[model samples]
Target: MIEFKNVVKKYDNNITATNNISVKIKPGEFVYVVGPSGAGKSTFIKMMYREEAPTSGSIIVNEYALENIKSREIPFLRRELGIVFQDFKLLPRLTVFENIAYALQVIEKTPEEVEQRVSRVLDLVGLSAKRDNFPAELSGGEQQRVAIARAIANEPSILIADEPTGNLDPETAEGIMEILEQVNKQGTTVVMATHNSFIVNEYKHRVLEINGGKIIRDEEEGVYSNEDANA
Candidate 1:
């Protein structure tokens, strides 16, 4: 579970990215953070993974107090969560299988354990056959799938995606969504920040509509439209 109470993040340039934001995301729930550019969606998601620290507030993610978590302990905290980015950050030289296995290897998982976990996640993302291919050899969608596979290879309880489908075509984005849906179905809490209103309306979930660094609306099975988002 994730909880943020009275979270306020400010930069040195006198800009407030998030203002007194408080929200609770329960386990086994799929939540969408939708808003226009510079609406604090990225900053909000980045805070969850400890990429950015709040100026003052409490953020508890899977029992780790992000605001006070030590640098060394951040790795341990990350092990309990999976994160995917808009740009597929894969090792260009490594094969798809190796890319997924790298994360497990860093944590000192046994060779057998790494192989098993990597295989399972690659299968989950439907990229088992592309296991031997390098990132450069794969399509954009395939690379994203590889990224997702790598993120979830350790079976993190929480999966966080930031504009995961931002670079893919409509059909390819839908395919990625299906993979995420499957992951969520298996009990991973999914928190995604997206601008694709079609995806939001087509696959409804809890929506936290943010604007001007504040949550304007929180609705279960919320539908988003361009007009509604800007309203």
Candidate 2:
């Protein structure tokens, strides 16, 4: 579960990335954060993951007040959250298996536990066959699958994906969505930020639209309304 109340984020020179935004995502729910470029979607996701601190207001994720979270405690907070990015953020040198295993290793998991968890998640993402491959050796979608595998290997309670399908073809993107949906069905809360209207329309889930650093609309089983088509 995630909750934000009157959250604001401002950069130097008084440019606001998020302006007094409040939203809640319940457990076992799937939501989409929809917006155009510079609409504060990224900032919103970053705040949830503690990548950037909000300038004001409060954020409660899994019952921990983010404003009161100490710098030394961020790693523990992140242990309960899974994050994926548009760029696929895979290391070129590490094999797929190693990449996913690295996530567990950082948490001080034993080698046997790391191997078991990484193997299971890779199988879940249909990347078991490609575990020995490097990022450059895999296709875009495959690399993204590996990235997803890495994110979920530790079984985080919440999953936040930013432009997860940004670089893939339509079919590939759809495949990625299916995997995300499957993950959601298994009880991980999913919040995906995307600009793809076709996918949003097809999925027909809760949609939150943001513009000019504020959330403009939140709808259940929503479509992409083009009110800010020119924004």
Leading candidate by TM-score: 1
Per lDDT, the best of the predicted structures is 1
Across residues 60-170, which tens digit of lDDT does each residue of candidate 1 receive? Answer: 999999999999999999999999999988989899999999999999999999999998998888898999999999999999999999999999999999999999999
Q: Which ten contiguous residues of candidate 2 have the minimum total lDDT?
A: 222-231
Whole-model Cα lDDT of every candidate shown, in order: 0.94, 0.91
What TM-score do all the candidates reach, one by one? 0.98, 0.97
Native-to-model Cα distance after best TM-score fit, residue 184 in candidate 2, in Å = 0.1
**Candidate 2 regions with alpha-carbon error over 4 angstroms:** 225-229
Error of 1 at 225 (Å): 1.2
Q: How many residue pairs clash in each candidate?
A: 0, 0
